[model samples]
Target: MVPPLALDIDGTLTTPEGTIAPRAFPLLAAWEAPVVLATGKAFPYPVALCQFVGIPERAIAENGGVALVDGHLDYAGDPERVDAAVEAFEERGGDLGWDGVDTVNRWRETEVAVSPTADEELLRDIAAEFDLAVVDSGYAYHLKSPDASKGAALTDVAETLGHDPGEFVAVGDSENDASTFAVAGESYAVANADETAKRAADRVLDRGYVDGTLDALRAIRDRAKNGE
Candidate 1:
């Protein structure tokens, strides 16, 4: 049988310009097994992606701070802790670098996302001070609870869905996806993947972006056919 799929959005499912790949929606919606959208993005983003793709609403968002399976919601991060960390970051002369209303984090429920233009080192330092974790998703820097990791969220989601976490295959392209790579039965890092993701994955695909994801899915199908 084909294993479930856990996919990262931004750089993995989208084109270089950050829009969803034209071929992605139909393929994911038609996949034989469950498809879980896993990312550092807020809850709404993945939920919407699943809806528009015509798939079940299964997602792990906010770098694992939040998970939604079917209609049930689960939360791992404490908003109070994230609020404190964001306050400390601002007090330390840190600018989130958003040009206007900071829409990047306006609807986020668990973590604070800083633009790539901000000081990553200083943000990491601030996150450490508050006992939080910082992960660079290539598109942005996320400050979140250390306990909230994609791997842990996958495990929780898998149990809730009546499957083992190891029965899922994960595809991604950033350091934030490393934890997921660790938990998945098989993991692939696209060509443009960060070094962390490359190191964590079982194989690094030759293609990048959605092309690489398509390749990974093909490989999974081949493996099932071969009884691997």
Candidate 2:
């Protein structure tokens, strides 16, 4: 069996404008492996997509702040800690909040997701005030748990699912996913990924979005077939 896949949804699964690629749904539907949709998306989408793909039982969301399985939600940080970080940012008149990100992304229980338009340095400074952590999702700056992260969660899930970390393929195109890349046995970055993200990958695809993903997957499958 192929190593389980841990994928980021934004630029890797969707187009640059954040629309789901035309090939995405079908590609996922036909997959026959233990794959986790790892992303910064809050909810519903994670759960909803999981349902659409026959894995409605588990998801990784909120940049690693949340883990959902069998409709159960697990959080890495306490609400009080998250709220204090939020409050610290709010002390600056809450101007660091992002409005351009997906509108429904408001229910950030474990972290506050801010748009790129927000002051990155200021946001980091605010999190520092309360000993919180701020990480970039390529598109947003998230104030989140000091320890729980996309990479850590991916590794955790892979282990729980009985796969060695070396048997996991982590894919993404953002900063939040950098951690996932570091922990997984193989890492792939789409053509549209940022420089930092691309640098972290073991392989760089030629295409973007799901097309690029499918292309790379085919090569991996071929390699296994050839005993290479």
Candidate 3:
């Protein structure tokens, strides 16, 4: 049996404006393998996606910091790690912008979104100083728990399903997807992906954003079903 397929949302499976490609739905429905939506998008977002693609309710949200498994929230690992990290971030004079920590709660389970103005240099500094991972997701910077990551979340889902990470395919298109690309047996990047994402990917699709994602998903389903 093929292992599960993990996908990112914002620049991978969906357009930046949150549109799902028309062709993606049928292809996803036809595929026998579990297609896990591993995304930074919050709860109801995935609910809408499930309705769109006709896939299972399982999803990795908040950049893998939270999981919705069989219609319940599965907080990954210890809760104290998240608390300590947030406290330390605050102590260091980290300005979470206007919304403050409430913005983090909105993502569900306390994964904070740093200011969009916080660039890679600042992220690196925060990471080095706080011993926390700052995931750069284009529109926002995510201050995540130490255990939270796309790859780690994918691993958790795969293990729960009794599958090996080496057998799974991952599709994504940003800095947050770095670890995910590293872990998956196969990795793909959309045409609109950043230079770093393209470099990390095993295959870069010709299509762009939602359309590209639809094309890629169709290709994966075809290849998986027919051994093409």
Candidate 4:
């Protein structure tokens, strides 16, 4: 059985400053399962990450808005939900824009990039008012569609690969990752995860940031291999 692994970037895979740890490369090189980077960063960021991680083509980009498979732009899902969400944002006095959506490698999942300087606080307030889940990535904010989520994106990839959802593990460190953790067979959070994320996780690592995240991945991989 192949186990799929979904990893979050930023505070999870890299430090808060966006540097991938040196220890990570070797471990990633040895990974046997399909590894997906699930993040809120845009194509350029994930494209850079794919170069660094040596998986330059196989990745999900734009938070499920785009899907890249085997170095190609395989799928770009409907933007109806995101479009509606954007309209709602505008109605709330928030201006959000996307240059274009594509499945570019850089991070863990398919993602759509909102303007880096988008007004996050206002977006969050609007999201809350509309009962939507707002993901704040410091540099940008995302309003997830009811059907578009990291978990849903991972499920789509797993299905395409003929893997069971129950065989996959997910690890993340923020509110955006809440759904990702919730849908995984086993889920984890770094020690520094927010209250909501920590509460949603099945386990919490002893460390935080890249160190904690790498350790958590190793633990999950080992546990699966050993049937622990």
Candidate 5:
């Protein structure tokens, strides 16, 4: 049987330029086992991704602050603390690093996503004050509840789907994906992965971005065939 999959979005499924790779659609849709999209992006983002990819709507969104599994919605991270953290950040003369309307976080439900262009140190400090954690997704900096993490969401979703967390293989490429790497039975980081993610993964692929994801998928298929 094919191993279940938990994949990160930004640097794993998308191109270096951040657009979803066109090739991923058919492969993901045709896969026999469950495919869960785990990302720091908002809930709607991954939900829509599943729809477009022609897969079941299984997603861990907002850095695990929110999750949707077969129509069952679960929420973690505290939006109140996120609001406080944002207020503190602004008070310290920090910008969420967006001009005008802050669309990056407009539709976000449970946590706040800040631009990587913002002051990382300041964001971390404010997050600490608000009892939140800061995760650098390579695309953005997310301020979220310490209680939220991709690993936790994966565990929950796996159980709900009648599988063990260790039955899934994970693929990702950033600091935010580290939690998932720690929990998956097998984990791969793309060549472009951040140092934190590389150290956490079971294997680091030679290819980057979408190519790396394809490589990981091939490896998984080989493993299944060889019964390894």
Candidate 6:
């Protein structure tokens, strides 16, 4: 069987214009392995995207803060812990309502995504204050529990679908995706990815957005056919 593909949302799936590439939907449908939408978007958004793509394989949302299965959200982090983290973050003048890069804090559960201008160390300190963790998600920094992560969510869903964590092709274009890259047997980063993510990936695609993702997927399909 072809290994599953764990995909990042934002910069990886959408073009620079922030629209899903027209070719992406069908390619996702025809792919050999399961396609999991792993993103920082809220739980419902990715699930809705799955419906739009006509595939409901599995989805990881909120930067690994939760997993959506069978139309129900499976909370991956302690709500109380996350709330405490949020309080601490705000008390230190860290904005929970940051919208610097076209992102809003509305409707997000378990974790909060702040503007890119946020101080990483300060955020980490806040997380540490509440025994939580802060992760960089390319466009923003995320505050979540230390154990809640995209890699763990991917592995969890992969196992439910009868796949191994190491047999996946994780693809992304952000620092948050580094965790997924670390766990996957193979990882690909889009041309627009941050340096940290590019370093984590096994290969960096020449193109950006879903086109580059399709390019990588087609390459993977070819390698599988060749028994490579």
lDDT of 4 by residue, 1-228 (tens): 236677887788877676777678777666887777877766556566767777634455555555554544544444454456567778877766544452322232322345557777777666566555556554456565445666776777777767876677887887778878877898888887887778989998899888887887777668768886
**lDDT, ranked from best to worst:** 5, 1, 6, 2, 3, 4
Tell me the tens digit of each residue's lDDT in model 2 across 130-206. Answer: 77888777777777878878877776677667777678788888778788889888999988888878888998889
Q: For each candidate in the order shown, give its overall lDDT on alpha carbons.
A: 0.90, 0.76, 0.72, 0.67, 0.91, 0.82
Q: What TM-score would each prediction reach against the true structure?
A: 0.96, 0.89, 0.81, 0.75, 0.97, 0.89
**Across residues 1-228, which tens digit of lDDT does each residue of candidate 1 receive?**
889999999889988778888687776777888899999998899999888999999999999999999778999977798899888888888988989787789889989899999988888888888888888999889888889998999999999888999999999999999999999999999999999999999999999999999988987888888998
Global lDDT of model 1:
0.90
Question: Which regions of candidate 3 deviate over 4 angstroms?
Answer: 1-3, 16-18, 70-73, 77-94, 98-105, 118-127
- Candidate 5 residues lying further than 4 Å off, grouped into runs, are 226-228
In candidate 3, position 144 carries an lDDT of 67
Stretches off by above 4 angstroms in model 1 are none
Q: Please provide, for model 6 over 1-228, each residue's C-alpha lDDT reduced to its tens digit, 9 standing for 90 to 100.
A: 567889998999899988877678887887777889999877777888888888874889888888875545667887688777777777877765454553455677878777778767777887777788777776677788778889988888777778888988999998889989999999999999999899999999999888889899888888888888
How well does candidate 4 score on lDDT at residue 11?
80
**Model 2 bad stretches (over 4 Å):** 70-73, 96-104
Q: How many backbone clashes does candidate 1 have?
A: 0
* Candidate 5 structure lDDT: 0.91
Candidate 2: give the clashing pairs.
none
